[model samples]
Structures are given as C-alpha cells and as structure tokens.
Target: MKGLLVFFFIFILIGPIVADVPVREEQFIYSIMAFNGRDYSRTFCGENSDTIYLIADQDNFITTSKTLVYYWPITGDWKTDTRSLNYSFEGTLELTEKRRESRIIYPERYTFYNVKGEYEQNWKVAMGDEADKAWQHYQGLIDEYWQATYQYEQAKMAFDLMVDELAMKITEMRNDGIDVTGLVEKLKRLGPPESPKPPDDYIVPPMPVQSAFILNLPRGEYNICFINEDSAVMESSEKRVVVFEKRRADGIGFEVIPGDKWTRPVESKRSSSVLYVNGTTDLYLRPFFQDEYNDLYYQRMIRNDAKGNPSLMNWVYIQQVPGGRIEVTKNNHTSAILVEEPFYVEQTKGSALGYKIVPFDPEGAHKDRDPSLIAFKIPITRETSLIKFELLDNSGLNMAGSSRQVRVIIKSRWQPILLVLCLLPLLVMTVVRMIRSRKYSL
Candidate 1:
C-alpha cells in the first residue's frame, strides 16, 4: 500500500510535466493582425484555443493557415511552426454576431502604414487594388533608398578621405610656417555628405502575405468559422469572439524619453510617478493622450491566454498631444517654459562610450541625419532639486493630474553614506561579539 501511494503521488507530479511537453501537430490556425484600439498587433488562434478578444468599431484582420501548431507551456499560449509547413486555405469566414444572421466575408489584399508627424503616428489602412498600389510604392521607395544608400556610402568615404588629406595639409603648412586658415575655411565649406534618406514608411504592412479577411464590426459577441468554397463549414474552425470597448477615454500620460538612450525608454503609466534624472544628461518628456481599459480584457485581446487583473486598469497611448508647453517650477516658482522641439543624439567616436544630446535643426549639422526624437527638452543642472512639471493644453489651460515632480540625483554624493552604512553592520556585529565574549568571561 505504501509503494502504491508513492507511485500515485509521483504520477500526479510528473503527469502535468509530461503533458506540458506539447508535441507539434498539424492543425488549422487563424493568423490575425488585430487592432487593439491603439495599434495593430499580430496574434493567432489555433486548435488548442477556441476564442479571440478584440476591440470594437475597428478593422481587425484574420486569415487561415494550415501549419504545425503546438502549445508553449511556458507562456500558456499556442504557437505555430509556419516556416516548416504553412499552407493557406481558400475559403470564406462566416461571422455570426448577436441579433444578426451569419454573413460571409472574403479575403482581399490589405496594407497599412504610418505616414508622417514627428510626435504622432497617422496610421492608415488600404484594401484591394489600393493596398496593392501602396505596397508597390513602398517597395519601390525601399529599393530607391538602398540604391541611394550605396551612392551615399561612396560619397561619405570620399568626404572622409578629403578631410584626412586637409588635416595632413594643415599640419604640413604649420610645420613649414605657412598660414592655413584659408584652407580651414575651405574645409568647413566642404560639409559632410548628405546621408540617403529612407521613405516615411512607418509601415506595418502585411508580410509573407498581402491579403486577409478584414472584419470591422461593432461591440458585441461574435461567432466566427471558416466556410469552404462548397458552402460547408470547416471542422475545428468555429470560435467565440468577445468584442470589448474601452472603459475610460481621455486619460493622460507621458512618454518619458531619457537623454542618453532615446531608442530604449522606460515608460511609466502612473501619472503620479516622479521623474528622476541624473545630473549629466537632459531628458525629453513627451506628453501623450491615452485611454484607459480593463487590464484583463486588454491583455487577452493582445494575446490569447494572457493573464491580468480585472480590477486593474491599463492605459492605451492614443496620440501625442500636439502643441503643448511643459512648465518647470522649482520651490513653487515658475523657472522656465519648455516648448516642443526636435533633438538629435550623436554617439561618440570609436573606442569611446558616450552620447551628446543637442538641439536638432533640419537645416543644421544634422541635416544629413534624421531627428532622433521630438519632445520638450528638460535641461538639468547640478543645483536642480524637487522640480515640478505641469502640462498645459494648446489653449493654455493647465491639464489636471498631469503635474509631476522631477528629482535630480547625484549618485556619487551617496557614496560616503553608503560606505558608512555598509561598515555599520560589520561594526555592530564586532562590538556585539566582543561584548558577549567579555560577559561570558566575567
């Protein structure tokens, strides 16, 4: 009886572990490019799942593909091996929503791209021949960019050599006691070769595909299944769809951009959180308009099996607030009014590790390079302390709850305190041990 109980307990433990090693099996998967109120994200529904969540009143895309599907036990989500064997199905998707009869939708070419606007994105989608034209135009632009890049590379190489030659000539003239200031002026006139500018293709156009069934529906429960060309519903294709709505619109947040690393930023959704800065680099804080939604619904909409709190809320960044000023106050005194400006971060030369953030002007030195980012530059000094930031609308009205505290930290100044704190623990231990020894002896 003891041996049998041990066997049962071991089986119970290892049964889950064995089951979690999911084998890749052939199945039909609904590959999707779902819009989550803010942006379009790529996710999928497979044989292992029966539901997909999406936001309403927007166009969401779906297409069927026969591929090797498997459960990713770690993430508790289904994944597909599309590269191995991905086969498309020729069928129509039948959607049955509440109070509506089942309607069939056909797949067509579709594409989307964000055109221009330094602070915000203008994401636009096109379908049918328009999508085809957009895709072709984008591809043509990409090809032209590559060709221009090759030419620019050659030009840059020549420019660098010319600069080097000029430097050598200046050295030679100086050694020979000849004035070379004119040559220096000529070198200055010969600016850097303009870099090849890529197209304004902030594009997330469909890849490995150019067609899908576009589903733009209102908020309600939906039933979706693939129907074959012969008007027969495919097996394992039926799934439930939960179309949810955003809870709160007009939420406020800041897209916190740091000085040194602009590409990689730490985003804080909490409006009450303090913005900490170091003395060395300035920060570019971009205030954004966002919407609030239930965390559970939002995450599940993005990923099939994502977990979140129903009570907690999430912020969906909708757009960058156009034309605003950030008021910087120190000790309750208005210090400066920061206006929106473009800035460029130039990386230091070879073998050195640092960056310099400077005001970006398209017609200036960075004319050859694109503006890294645009925001209100928060210039910090050594004496900066407890600074308050207030966001104002274009009409000069102060946005409520948008106020935040900025604290400048000098990490080096804490060294002495940290050293003393570290030694205090050892000091206490030594004194206690000595006192105990003396007491025991007495």
Candidate 2:
C-alpha cells in the first residue's frame, strides 16, 4: 500500500514536465540558389535587406519561392526547406544600370570535360543558337528508332508464330506415319531472328536554351529591385548588390595535406604563414593560384547575410596549377629541390596490424593502381628544426606566392618515464596502506 502511493505520487509529478515540451512551428521564407559551373550554390537570406554577390562572366539563375523552415534544437541548424510553395510574384529584376547581358547559347551537342588541375567541370558548347532545329532533329531520330524497334518486334512475333505452326504440322504428319525428314532438315536451318542493335552514339538533346547574365561591373555599389505586376517596387524583394574587384591576382597558395590526416587539409594562403609539424612526418602539397578580396563584400555576395565585416580581407582559391617544383631549405643552409614522387601504403600483417608507407614503384608492386599523389617526401631530422619552402617554376624561377616556412618541434623521449614516475608515488602509498591494514588486523 505504501509502494503504490509513492508510485502514484512520482507519476503525477513527472507527467506535466514531459507534456510541457514545445513543438517547432513551420515558417515560410524565400529561397535562392545558383549554379556555379560545377554544382548549385545556395544563397541563404537571413533578412530582407541582405546583399547577394555573384561572379562576373558566369551563369546565374534566380527564382523566388516560399518554403517551410524549422529550427532543430538537436543539431542547432535549420532543417532543409521542404514543400516548395512557388507563390506567383510576377516581377522583373530591375538593375540600376545595364549590366553585361549573357549570350543565349543553344548547344545542339555538348561534351563535358574535367578542368585541368582544377576541381571544376568544363563544358564544350557545340553549334550554338539552333536549339529548336536540334530538338526537332533529335525528335525525328528518336521516332525513327522507335519505328525500327516496333517493326522488328512485329516481324519477330510473326516468325515465332510461323515456326510454331510448322512444328505443329510436322507433329501431326509424324503421328500419321508420313515421311517428314526433308521438312525437319529445313526447319533446323531456320533459326529465330536476331535482335536489332540500337543506333550508334545516339545522344539525347540537352536543354533547348540556356540564358545567363554576365556581371562585369567596376567596383561600386548597386541595387536590384523586383518590379511587380502593378509596376510597383516590392519592398522585401529589393536586394543590395556590390561589385568589387580582386586586390591581387598573382598570389600562389597551397593545400597542405598531412600524412597523418589527409581529409582535414589545411590551406597555406599567405607567403609568411609558418606550418608547424611534430617529429618526422610526410607532407603532400598541392599548389593553387589564389586571389584576395574583401571579406564582407565576398561573403555577402556568396550568402545573403545582414552582418558582415567589411574591414577584413580573405583569400579565394582560383585553381590548382602544375609545372612547379618545391625547394625545402632547412635551418637556412641545407636545402634540396624536391621533385614529385609516387608513394604506396602497405598494410602490416600479424596481430598488431598497422600501415607502412613506402616509395611507390609503378613497374613492380603498384602496376595495376595509380599513384595516390605526386608528393615531395621531407624527412624532418632532430638537428634541423626550422624549414622553409620555395616554389619554382619549370624554368627555375622563384614563385613569389609559394614561399612558406615549416617549424618542427622535437618530441620528448622522457614522456613515458615521467608518467611512470608520477604514478609511482600513488602505487607506493597504496602498497603501504595495504601492508599497514594487514599488520593492524594481525
């Protein structure tokens, strides 16, 4: 009876606490995403007056739509915009001045290519401004293929029926004790019709037309407003536009890939930044051409945020480049021009399994596989602590943008001994206590 009363009291006290949790409500907002050559880049709008930046001489698409947004407390990030409610707001994007208009390219046939040494896709536009004609031509080809397929199917059905009928007649004649040896020989020679091959290199036509706006303007401020059907400017549809140029275009940057952690690559943007590493380690370096721009203007251009620091500058990676050799100088004297080499990671055998990295040999072990990276192996010795790197072009000229330093910190060999010494006092105290307790009990 007492246990029951306590259980009822506990349940009554906890019920209201669980029921008071609040549920998130769905809210609608505008969404804008643009395709920047490779993939779609989303521009999140935090407020109505945020500015949106876009690169000049590129393709950009803009659409205004309503979407559901909810805050998830677990992740602390906004949930994906679901249920696209495209509210019809008939308007025209009005710019202050006439920007460079994009050329309407009607690619009849296009081929995709991987950009050399860069993470971008290059599309080769072929036969421009005849999209309708190309669509009609491809439609005609599809119809012809369909007709051929249909005719082949009908002919195959008819052949199968005739073969079945002949076999039935032969069976009937055989039951009647009539000679059908010559007919059987002819039937053996007549096999089923072969399937027709599809048309060679048939490529489906792409989009009928592609339109883009080229934003090639000088460094200045601009405004873009949407004029509604009533010819009135939409208050929330107005967005600020800033056109800025790169500060410097001839800077070289590096994507530093550590041997221990390759996925978490660090960028060496400026020439004076020092890369610190502990003990002997292998480093894979990928050089890139970078440009500097204002942080506020650049960030606002990429995302629609009301708060941005206009005073700071940031480096933007343009593309990766080759034909450069890296020179590693240790302690300002011992230096070596490091060339690109292949490496292989071999897994260890037995109970204590591990991985061992060695110089890759294409003709021997790694014949079937390609080298993971074209890297320079730097063995950090204990005596040589400070190291600096200089990038040189193929003609043996120093690359001003690729100069950086590496500082090595020697690992302490007495760390294990120190840890043991610290734990010895505790172990001795524990043993003494045990000994004292035994002596007292006795």
Candidate 3:
C-alpha cells in the first residue's frame, strides 16, 4: 500500500521528534535570590516548596545546592537548574528576627544610558553615599582604559613594521632606476596608526564577590536557618521568609509604550483598567512606582509556585517617577499638560513607505541623539475618543495611583457595511448555482 503509506508518514514525523527528549531529575533545591531595587531576583525552591520572597530593605541570597531538575516543554515550566549538579551547602542564613545582617564588599556597577535608535544597556548598583566614591572612580577609569589599550597595541605593531619596511625600500629603489619621487612622497605621508580613544564611559566593573546575604530587615515574618559545616540544621535548609511591605506606597504604575508597538509594553494597572486604544498611532507613557500584592502573598514571596492565586491582586513595579506632568483629559472638557517630549522617527520617502513621528530638536535635529522616551506624545485623533490620565507631582500634586482610561476605537464608515454583508452569502451561493445549471439543461 505504497510502502504502508510511507511507513505511516514516517511514524507521524518521528512522533514529535521522539517527544522532545528532556526528562532529567536529581533534586535538592533552594537557590534563592531577592535584591530587587535593581538586581538579584530569582527565588525558585521546589521540593514541596514553601514561602521565600524578600525586599523589606533589600539584599538577599541563599544557598543549598544538589541540582538537575528538567521537564520544560517550552515554559510549561521547570528546566535549567543543573549547575553541573551543584552540591554546595556550607551556609549561614539564620534569621528569625535576630537580624544583624551585613557582609558588604561591593564593586559591580553598570548603568549606561543613551538609546534613541534602540539597544541601550543597563546594570546599575551604586546606591547611596556615592557608592564608594563611585566605585573608586569607576575602577580608576577601568585601569586607565586598560593601560591605554596596551599602548595602542604596541603603537599599532610598530606602525605596521615601519610600513612594511618602507614598501621594501621603495621597491628596491625603483629597480635601481633611482627616481623615488621623494620616497613616494614619504610613503604617502606615513598614514595608518590612529586607534587609542576609548575611555568615554567605559564599564567593566563587577568583581569582589562573596555573593550576598545582607538583609537590612524591618517588615516582619521570618524563619530562614541554614548553618551547616557541622553546626548542623541543613537537610532541606529551612525557609519561610516573607518580609514584604508596600501594599500602597504612592501607587501610579503605567509603562504603556506603543509607538506602533515598541516591543509590546502595555501595563496600566487599574484605575479600573479600560485601555482599548487604536485611534491610529504614537503613545509611550512609562510612569511607575506601584505596589498592591496578595496574589497568594506575591506568589509565595516570588516563587515556590504552587500556582499562586490566594484571592488574586498583584501589581509590584516600584520605581521610575521622575518629575511627572501628564494631565491629558479630553471628553471631560479638553485639558492637555504633557511635558517630556523629544520624538524623531522619520523614515518615509516614497512608494507608500510610512513612519513619521518628528519633534526632537535638542538644539536642532537630534544634536547628539538619545531621547526616544521620557514621553507623553499620544496624538491619535479620528473620533471615538475618551482619553483621560493625570499624574502631576513636581509640586502640582495629584499622583496617587495616577488616574487612567483610554478607549479610542474610531473605525466606522458603516464599517464597509460588514464587508457587504460578508459578500452577500457568497453572492447568493453563486447565483443559485447558476440557476440550477440552466434549469437542468432545459
């Protein structure tokens, strides 16, 4: 039967490539993390998991190893724990309120910034008291830019070996004919040897590790325990931490983005939701500083995930709220306010190409670029509106959970009469099958 239908289409295409292999196993977990104020975030723990979350005055890090753990059929979750089957356990975490946490050793800074046409970068850590004098002046400008890039690569390898021995002594003095024309105009004015200019904001920082465990405590519910290396108490390393605090600390939270989808940002966070949009283009909001919680106590304080949901409620975010102004309004009587601008996208020059955006002047046409989003441009007109927003602060006040609402829509000119009533039932079933094939061929 045609080779059994090509062996049943090669066993249904190798049965999903042999059910995508990966099953793994080995256990013992707790590798905790938690320093969010810009860093350490992880917190996984499954062996009949238990609470963990931190952030009540930052700094955290736990240990307990023995690895492997697989499964992950594409985020149906759980893979990536095999740190070469770790097995480390030699700790000292012990909290239960006897606080006293400190072990500082610092030096891992990184916070770049300059992204107008995308791909910027970020790492940040330098907090307070001028983070050790800006990490010793950024590690003395990264050791003087790596000793001026090793003396500019040994003066560009001795000026490319003296320009290849002056072009082989001007080609043996022009094959002895002698008219070198001033040694080929001194080898065309001895060119090529520039390079050495890197130190403008050099980075390379992070090194001085002893890895974290600095607690700073304050907001309650602890338990921790680890202590091994003989003082026993290790076994599954004990957990239950919690710490939280932020259920409502100057709310707000936006992020939005959308200049035709700048990497899908969208997160408004309740003033009773309603963000519909699509009145044409340009958006970019941002905002931040949030809080809320409870989704099973913030997913068991970040992870130990038995699927969360303790009467739902989430939020979190926290920072970015610089200067503000927003306002917007519209149907509740016009308004406007706005503020942080600088746009510039441009692009269309022919054949229906598109992108325009505009407004970015710095001192005239993006003088040194970098501005793409400290935004609030939102100009989507067509009609079906609503709008609304608010924010303020910078002495103007208002910013608590910064109002919301968007709705826009617009699209109807009788909406193409529902595409001609969906092509009128496929044009009346092809004119009643052409009048029943000419009335059954007469």
Candidate 4:
C-alpha cells in the first residue's frame, strides 16, 4: 500500500510535465509610456492588472495594444509577445474623475534622447513637431553614415590593392640588392581608410503608431477607458488611474558594491547605513539623489502590479550629484577625499568569483580593459571604527542633506567558542574546590 501511494504521488507530479500545455493566452493590454518621477519609460498592464498608477504632476502616457500575453511560471510574472502579435487600437482615451469631471485625450507624439552635458539630469523629451524634427535628424544621420560607409568600402579596396603592389615592388628591390629604404618608409606611412561611425543609440527611434494619451494631473483618483469610433466605452480597456507623488524629495543615496561580493551590492537607500563586515573592505559607491514614495504606489507606477508594502516608503533614484566629491571621514576627524574615477573589475578564474577592483589607466596595458564602474572608492580597515561620508561640490561646500554615517561592526570568527573551551578546566577546578570545602565542613 505504501509503494502504491508513492507511485501515485510520482504520477501526479509528472503529469503536467509529460503533457503538452499552452501557457500563452491572447489579451488586449494597456501599454504605458510612464513618467517614473524622473523620465518617461515603457511599462504595461496585462489582463492581470485592473489599475494603472503614475507619479502625480507629471506627463504620463498610455496606449492600448492587443498582443499575446503569457504567464512565466519561473518568475511568476506576466509577459507579452509584442513583436509578432502586436495590434494597436485606434481610439481616444477618456478620463472621468468622481463622475463629475470628464476629459477626452488624443494621442500625442513624444521622443527622448540623452543630452551630452549633465547626462543624468538632462534626458530631454521632445514632443509634437520637436519629436518629428529629432527623428528626422536621426534618420538623416543614418543615411549619411550609410553613404560614408559605402565610400570607405570602395576606397579601402583600392588602398589594399596599392598596398599589395607596393609590397611586391619592395620584395623585387630587395631581391635585386637595391637600397629600398625610402620605398619601405613610404609604404609604412600608408594607412587604411577610417571606418564610418554610427549615431548614438540613446537617441530613441520614434514610433508613430505607438501614440499614447499623456496625463499630467495632480494627486487624485480617476477612471480611464478607451473610446472607439462607435461611441462605445472599452470595458476591457478600462483601468483605475492612481496619480501619486513622492513623500521625501531629493535625498542622497548610495549603491555600495563591495570588492569581494560584486553581484550582491548593498543599497544604502538613505545616505547612512551600518555596515557589518569582517576585517577590511573596498566599496564602489555610486551616489544619486532620490525621493521617497509609497512602496506600493511607486511599484504600481513603474510595473504592472504593486508588489511591496503599502505603508513603507521606497526611494526612487533620480540623478547623480553634479560635480561633487565624496568626503569619507574616519572616526569623525581624519578624512579622505575620494574623487569619481573609472575603475575596472578584473575577474581571475572562471566561475571562481574573484574580482580585483583597480583604477583604470588608459595609457598602459589596462587601456584595453573597459571600466566596470565609475564611482567613489571608500576603503575600510580594522583600525577604522566609524565612517562618515558626505557629498561636496567643487567650491568645497557640503551638499545639504547629503551627509551619512556608517558604524562598522567587525565580526570575530570562532573566538568566543575557543575561549569557552579553554576555560573548561578552570571551571571544573572551581567546582571541585567548592565540593571539597563543603565535604570537609560537613
């Protein structure tokens, strides 16, 4: 009976694995071009979601797309197949607040590109005519690049033929015992044709059909739905819109990546966090200013669902500090100023997970090695007890609200256990002496 029960359990577990199952389902999803407190990004709401969230007082974008939606059981998340099966809906969006206020919105054109100076803080968004112009400019750059590439290819072929002919002549001169020093020098001076360069990938291509309804509303709850040509409201396209704002704004935070554990970087959401480590550590600190928001509301704004605690506050990173150095104060007096520089993380053996973080020197053999991180390096030692770090501008003034302290608690390994074991004989002797005294007195 026990054997039969075990067999039944095995059969039940393998039944799904042995059978063919369709994990994907067709559904109309509301794709969004959302403003995530800093910049506009793409996110979606599938059949599993009934509400759409956004940061209040910002231009949020949304559109309707019919695509194949699937449940990814591994991550327990819903994914969409938009490339092969995306069918865009043609309709205007209607937003009604409290059933008293109503607004109809048409699709708007928008594009974004990373600007050169102050990159983190300057992701410029072009809208309408500006969007069209920027896209056309990018297209023109593409055409010019192709033309240049073709010309270079033709010139390179001729250059290669000339190089080969010159090589043959030089060989003949050498064989005939003639002085070919000048000819060799001339050949050495000849170089290959320069390759044509492509445009920056950060200038996003514009999509006309991917039009979205931009909503820039103050804090409130609103009901939004798609309006078709037949003057009918799309029930499947309906969603509850929640426009929220940040609680605490512009607080500096750091993503502390330790040398030993590269993958498991510790996030100091606030500038200050206690670091409990062993002996010594080197940290790669990427600092940014951010705002605190409701955990649930912020997640709901960026993704399909609010997957965190509603009561807790979540820090949303906005941008890196402009022209600042990291001042690390050891024991609150002795200090070291760490400037932001490129550093490379060199991996030793394959799968051994050994990494050495070194300063990037472009002139030496390390020139070919691309930098893995651009951050302020903070070195901690056993002698240093407390650490306080703050951001400072070029004028040597402290950035307000950018100060934080880290209390380092070094951990000892097996010391307490060894001490107890060493004192066992002393404890035994004390007990024996007490027993002997009591026996003699009795």
Best by lDDT: 1
Ranking by TM-score: 4, 1, 2, 3
Model 2, residue 18: C-alpha shift (Å): 9.4
| Clashing pairs in model 4, backbone N/Cα/C closer than 3 A | none
| Segments of candidate 3 deviating more than 4 angstroms | 1-33, 41-59, 62-91, 95-145, 148-150, 153-205, 211-222, 225-240, 243-267, 270-272, 275-283, 286-312, 318-364, 372-377, 380-384, 387-442
Clash pairs, candidate 3, are 66-87, 252-401
Count backbone clashes in candidate 4: 0
Candidate 4 residue lDDT tens string, 57-127: 77777778789888766676678887769988788989989757788998888766655555454565667
Instruction: Report each candidate's C-alpha RMSD, comma-separated, in the order given.
Output: 12.0, 12.9, 28.9, 6.2
Candidate 1: Cα lDDT at 252: 70
lDDT of 3 by residue, 1-442 (tens): 9999999999999898886767667766776665544345576675556567666875455556768777677666665466567776655666665355633222222222221221122344443444466566767767887888888789888888988888899899899988888988888898766676755553335333334345556677777766666767666656677786666655787888777766578788776787888777767787877777666766555555636676777777756777688888877888888877767776768898666667787887788887665677767664738888878988887776688878788666898899999899999999999999989995
lDDT of each residue in 185-226, candidate 2, tens digit only: 878888776676664433323344433222344556666665
Question: For candidate 2, which ten residues in a row score worst on lDDT?
Answer: 104-113
Off by over 4 Å in 1: 1-22, 71-78, 117-119, 129-209, 258-264, 274-282, 344-367, 371-373, 379-385, 407-442
Measured by TM-score, how close is model 1 to the native structure? Answer: 0.65
- Candidate 3 has a TM-score of 0.31
Alpha-carbon local distance difference test for all models: 0.82, 0.64, 0.68, 0.80
